[model samples]
Target: MSNTISVTLTVNGKRQTITAASDTPLLWVLREELKLTGTKFGCGVGQCGACTVHLNGEPTQSCLHALKDVNGKTVTTIEGLSPDSSHPLQKAWLVEQVPQCGYCQSGQIMRAAGLLKQNPRPTREQIVEYMSPNICRCGTYVRIASAIERAARETGAQS
Candidate 1:
């Protein structure tokens, strides 16, 4: 076993204290340690985006991100987006019926949140360009795009 370090990170607006090897991936910490299992494990590598989480409020691939890199930083998962699905994106997701198999919804939602934080009115092409990294096997891309558009419009209206 390698040296296990104590990393205190803020997740979903709550602080988390965990002990693990410095190289342990954040994905395992979130799911196995913290019980925030909504962040799914798809590709153990970083290409799938199924285990995406937020580091410092930016969408990040947790599978490849080391716990040490996220120490003392704010992390957000799909669960942290909103408790009651009150967030515009969540509401829009429900309204737009974005999930197909639901395996990648969490990552998709997190990525959508990041996109909304930057561009509240992204065009269709812009959304495609921005969300191209995450792959969904259920083929929910159309609904996902629509959901993002709705969330963007709602957020823009509120702002």
Candidate 2:
């Protein structure tokens, strides 16, 4: 018998229902079923942050989270950050030119959003430490950090 099952969840602020194996990774469901392609697929083992998404307001690796795990949960992809790329982080990213190859940026941004939510005014050290897990092969660490700082400032994040 097929193991596909019905799962309902909220993605990008919208309710959705999808059918798939219970263990199917959330990444595939987001990309293949829900059509939220902003979350990229990287190392697939969750080591890389390319598939990062906010799960119930927390940054999570979509590649590792199973479809069943996200049932009735809320997920926010890069596209949901801001409809017009107007999030402070997005604007700061543009101002600081944080992207190189641009493949890992969505994950980076999502993770940064989570960080800012926890610590709105993280210092440079904290920014680096918190963002360490998200790798950028293009070596744009400096720019990324700068953008995050700018974002924090623009968003009126308290020091």
Candidate 3:
């Protein structure tokens, strides 16, 4: 077994201290260690964005992130994205009825959040480009794209 390291992280605005192997992926740490299971595991290899999360306000594949390297960092999962479901993305997704299988929605929303952070007023093509990394087996691409567009519009109106 690899040597374990202790680290502290602020996830969804909560600080936690955990001991894990340096190479352990953040996905496991969040779901198994911290019990924040909103982030799903689609592909362990990072090709699928089902395990995406936010690290210091940037979207990242938690499955590809090293636990030890995230010490003292801020991590946000879908649960954090909208504890009250107030995030425009979450609200827009609901308003648009975006999820089909529901398995990939969390990752898709997180990726959409990242996209809006960079471009709050993204075009349809832009939304597709930004969200291309996340794969939805349900093929909810149309609604997903529309949901992101909706979120972008909502966010733009807020600012």
Candidate 4:
């Protein structure tokens, strides 16, 4: 009885079939298997948002998501956010210099992308509320929020 089973999912706009233990976290599958290393590993208990990715268009902690639950789902990592690092958020992050340690920036950008997908123009309060889960040891929250705001403005001017 092999615990390893084949699970197929769409990753970064590409369909992939993976074989791994059912209990293996999506984070490992993404990093070790699929070679998408932008999604970093932090707390691994879902409290820290360093491993955030878009699972079925929702920001999910990949470390907490098991391979068994991810079959047929769509995952988008920081690499998928832009092929040429041209996404509004990426440009805004550069403009705002949001990364100090650069560990949590990928997850932060992914979460902000989710927020912008749900709300194109989020207020400062909304940005804070939405992004509170991600922790930046470098204490770059202000710049993160500013980058999000800049991306929102570049994405669209909406209330």
Tens-digit lDDT track of model 3 for 1-159 = 668999999999999998989889999999999888989999998998999999999998999889768999999999988769899989888989988879998999999999988888888898888888999999999998888888777777777
Q: Please give the lDDT score for candidate 4.
A: 0.94
Q: What residue runs in model 1 are displaced by over 4 Å at the alpha carbon?
A: none
For each candidate, the alpha-carbon lDDT, in order, equals 0.90, 0.92, 0.90, 0.94
Off by over 4 Å in 3: none
Model 2's TM-score against the true structure: 0.95
Give the distance in Å from residue 130's predicted Cα in candidate 3 to where it truly belongs.
Answer: 0.8
Q: How badly does each model clash, as a count of residue pairs? A: 0, 0, 0, 0
Q: Candidate 4 clashing pairs?
A: none
TM-scores of the candidates in the order shown: 0.95, 0.95, 0.95, 0.96
Instruction: Kindly state the number of residue pairs that clash in model 1.
Output: 0
lDDT score for residue 6 of model 4: 92
lDDT for residue 15 in candidate 1, whole number 0-100: 85
Name the lDDT value of residue 134 in candidate 2: 91
Pairs of residues clashing in candidate 1: none
Alpha carbon deviation, residue 152, candidate 3 (Å): 1.9
